[model samples]
Target: MRNLLIFCYFLLFFIGLSCKETKKEDINITTDDIEVSDNLQAVTKKSKSILFFGDSLTAGLGLDIEDAFPAIIQRKIDSLGLSYQVINAGLSGETTAGGKNRIDWVLKQDVDIFVLELGANDGLRGVPLSETRNNLQAIIDFVRQKNPEVKIILTGMQIPPNLGVEYTTEFKKIFPELAAKNKLELIPFLLENVAGIPDLNQADGIHPTKEGHKILAKNTWEVLKDVI
Candidate 1:
């Protein structure tokens, strides 16, 4: 009887030891999985952002959101396997003053690249050149204040002499002057080849057609590529 009892005790002890070893192996496997998850998370890249802030031109008035120049830029970035998120913060008829007013809200998101395209409406409306300049400067200041490291690209614009040559010329000068003052990148005349071309513009003769937006995207990509 004593021998049988001792044999039973030894069997139970060996069973408990085997169970402990199995539990330890499971814990090791769980730890390895956790470490692998952490490593994968560490290697994953976080996408930077490019924000296009302007009026109807940026907003793609009369067109789908995906057809906008910003969306086109996004496709270009994606094609190259670049990790940049393009945000079109364009509003139809947004002026420099309007941009200045809403820039804070726009800046709520992370913006590594800022493309400013606001003065067209201001110039078209014959808003005072000083007001336009001041508003643009304020908007630039707001962006800088939010993040001094932000890369701002000011898009140049031109208006007809109906606003007077002085106004028109100064309006054209606003972008470069602000660019120089702020040490920002400049896209000279955002509507370079497309502007004044009847085929490129819509019936309104103001906004660019889909093909025209492609040219806009190309013009932007020219300077944008160098920066990014």
Candidate 2:
């Protein structure tokens, strides 16, 4: 009986040690995750903001988010060792009016640079030229109001004349006019070489493929390098 008791005690002690080791391992794994928070805070503190606010093109549409122009831009920025954080605020199918509506909320964060890429959907939907212009203007006003020092970049867009030639011509002029009036930088057209290019565009021909996004990043980086 004494021998039996001894064996039982030894077994219980070994089991207890095993349980404690397992608990300690779990704790170590949790600690490693917690350690990542320190790095996150450092990154946040060091990074400045470059906000891309626009529609589906900015959102990447059918492509993977990483294949999106904004992410490509992010990679470019990182490659250059720039400290700017590229925030992709693109909403699929958003119009200038919708952008205006959300401008205030979007501006809650500090924006060092703002890229406005809206109005394409409005043209496609045949929204009035005046309304689109007004909405875009309002978004610009709100952005400046939020941060007067923020440098704004306006991206021009052209639509098929589903509405009419007159409407199409007027829509094309809106971006340049706004850029001139606001003294903001302009991209001329967001989808320059990629647009209407069968190989560059996806099957739908609206969004760009991975190769196309590379061109987009190049287009943006051209103007972007000068600014930053």
Candidate 3:
């Protein structure tokens, strides 16, 4: 009976020790999972982005990507101690119709400020003025739907008079009209100091040169600083 009692006690002791060891292993696994989850969260947390969406002009045609106005704007933001990322979603040859189609994909990430520089290609192509206006309005609406608090900076663009006087006049009015209707900040003529200047333009006479982009950045900064 004594021997049997001792054996029973030893068996109970071993069982308790095994259960404790299993619990410790389970705890270690849980701790590792939590650490991994925390690391992933830290890695994915990103700064709010100032998205520059437009065409070849915004894409920095005939210039280095870093020389683009959007990148220059990024430098300005950094200098001001702002915590914002600059995303250049500019595509060469993109028109208002294309922009309307692409805005959804471009806005997949969080955007704090949207600097819209489209409609130049649309005007140059002589696309219907009403269609261009509607497409631009749609893009703006989509951005607002994505983030109701997003601030928009619409940049005005002008084309040569080859598209007929009536078309040119109406095209020029679109930007301000949209700005007024949407209550958005407007940069009248993004190429104010650079347009019509030989030195400021590329060989194609359409896209702005590196020096011209500096002036463009200044124009954008003037209106952008007020909004942000």
Candidate 4:
């Protein structure tokens, strides 16, 4: 009887050790799972961001979201296996003043590349050249303040002859002037092949159609690809 009792005690001791080992294994598994989750979150947070900030031209007014140039750029980035995420902050009919007012809110997140495409609506509205320049400069300054390392791409815009030659010429010069002053990359013209072409533009003749967006994307990609 003494021998049996001793054997039972030994069995209980071994079982307890087995249970503790199993518990340790479970704890290790849980720790590994948590570590994996943390790694995934870190990767997501570290992905670079490219922000396309602009007006109706960038918004793709009459077309689908996928038809927009920003979306097209996203597709290109994805195809190249690039990790950069594109944020389209375009708003319809947004003037330089509107962009200036709204930029503070828009820049609440990280921005690696800032493609600025404003001042078109200002030109259309016949807003004073000085006011447009001031507002645009303010927006640029705000962006620089938000991210000093951000690569700025200023897109040039031109208005119809209704705005008069002096105003139109001055407006056209704004982008290059700002680009030179700020040492920013210039796209020269955003609507290069799309503007003035009836087939590329929508019925309003201001916004580009889906087919036109492809050309615009090409134009943007030419300069943007080099920077990225």
Which candidate leads in lDDT? 3
Give the Å error, residue 98, model 3.
0.4
> Which regions of candidate 2 are displaced past 4 Å?
1-42
Q: Give the count of colliding residue pairs in each prediction.
A: 0, 0, 0, 0
Instruction: Put down candidate 1 lDDT per residue, 1-228, tens digits, no spaces.
Output: 999999999999999999999998777457888889865653464368899999999999988999889999989997888877788899998988889889999889658999999989988888888999999999989998998889999998998788678888778888898899889999998999999899999999999999999999999999999888
Instruction: State which candidate has the highest TM-score.
Output: 2
TM-score of each: 0.80, 0.83, 0.80, 0.81
Q: Write the per-residue lDDT of candidate 2 for residues 64-106, one digit (tens) a residue.
A: 8989999999888877788888889999999998998888888
What are the lDDT scores of the predictions, listed in order? 0.89, 0.88, 0.91, 0.89
Candidate 2 displacement at residue 60 in angstroms: 0.4
Encode model 4's per-residue lDDT on 37-145: one tens digit a residue. 9667646954898999988778889988889999999899988988888888999989898899999899998699999999988888899999999998998999999
Q: Indicate the worst ten consecutive residues by lDDT in candidate 3.
A: 38-47
Clashing pairs in model 1?
Answer: none
Question: Judged by lDDT against the true structure, how good is candidate 2?
Answer: 0.88
User: Each prediction's Cα RMSD?
Assistant: 8.4, 5.8, 8.2, 6.8
Residue 20's lDDT within candidate 2 is 96
Residue 82 alpha-carbon offset, candidate 4, angstroms: 1.0
Worst 10 residues of 1 by lDDT: 38-47
